[model samples]
Target: MLDQQITRSIRKMIEAREERVRNGDANGYGVDFFGMLLQSPVNSNISLQDIVDECKTFYFAGHVSSSALLTWTVVLLAMHPEWQERARKEVIQVLGSDTPSFDGLAQLKIVR
Candidate 1:
């Protein structure tokens, strides 16, 4: 639903950025958040999923008033060290050291 819409929007944005680079107009988007996110350092191997995740994070975080929720989550996790350890183990088991993808996240039952 909403998630798909956001993914599609981010994909379109990425495509536009790639097209600009292809046309030698890389600076057309200027030095904004989106531009910064799209550019990688030399030899960086940022995948399309990585860019999409960044965009999704930025979009959702920007639209939400989540400070309280975040603080409570941190406090709860801090109060439950065993839960933290379990979540850590689950994440490691599911993703190893790789950046989490949507499917990988779904497989992390304990963390979820």
Candidate 2:
């Protein structure tokens, strides 16, 4: 059936990724996302299928939530120029440039 074919395809894709990971072929791969799953000690005992499932769940949820947050943030900033200006000033003060750091991101209390 269609469900079985879909499942088989997904399984094949995950197996291919796992093979790439095991073969030291990191090129063209989004290592950071996979790194998160690998960094957890508990993940070592998890099967490839389970890891793929969890990654898929996280990917879908992250995409949905981040998109919503970005949309709302843009809308709010558009509506409040003064607050947005303040935020820009704070970013320039904390970062001294347009680039953001993890440390600088933490200091962006105005955005919070």
Candidate 3:
């Protein structure tokens, strides 16, 4: 199923990250995650595989939760045309009739 594929992909990515971390690649963000596990005061022998598993779990959970929230938000926005229109109006007002510049976008507190 699709779930299995997603799990496998996440596992592969986590394994790659773990290898990079173990090899002293400081540029990887995975090093931070690994460091947190290393710094834990629990008196247990945590293996590299365990760290990679934790990373995969973290990645999958974060992806699933964010995707669900975004889907829900889109559905809600679709159901509420008035709110969508209001949001569009606010965007237009902030951007003006021209292409939006960084300063113009910064002025849109409501959009932000």
> Estimated TM-score per prediction?
0.49, 0.48, 0.34
Per-residue alpha-carbon lDDT of model 1 for 30-106, expressed as tens digits? 55667655664222677778879987886678556567667777898899999989988999989998755545777
lDDT agreement with native, every candidate: 0.76, 0.67, 0.64
Highest lDDT model number? 1
Q: Better model by TM-score, 1 or 3?
A: 1
Name every residue pair that clashes in candidate 2: none
Model 3 ranges off by over 4 Å: 1-62, 96-112
lDDT of 2 by residue, 14-112 (tens): 667657867889543343555444433343566656656766666657888888999999999999999999998887788896444344577888965
Better of 1 and 2 by lDDT: 1
Candidate 2, residue 102: the lDDT equals 40
Candidate 1, residue 92: Cα displacement in angstroms equals 0.6
Worst 10 residues of 2 by lDDT: 35-44
Cα RMSD, each candidate:
9.2, 6.1, 11.5
Which order, best to worst by TM-score? 1, 2, 3
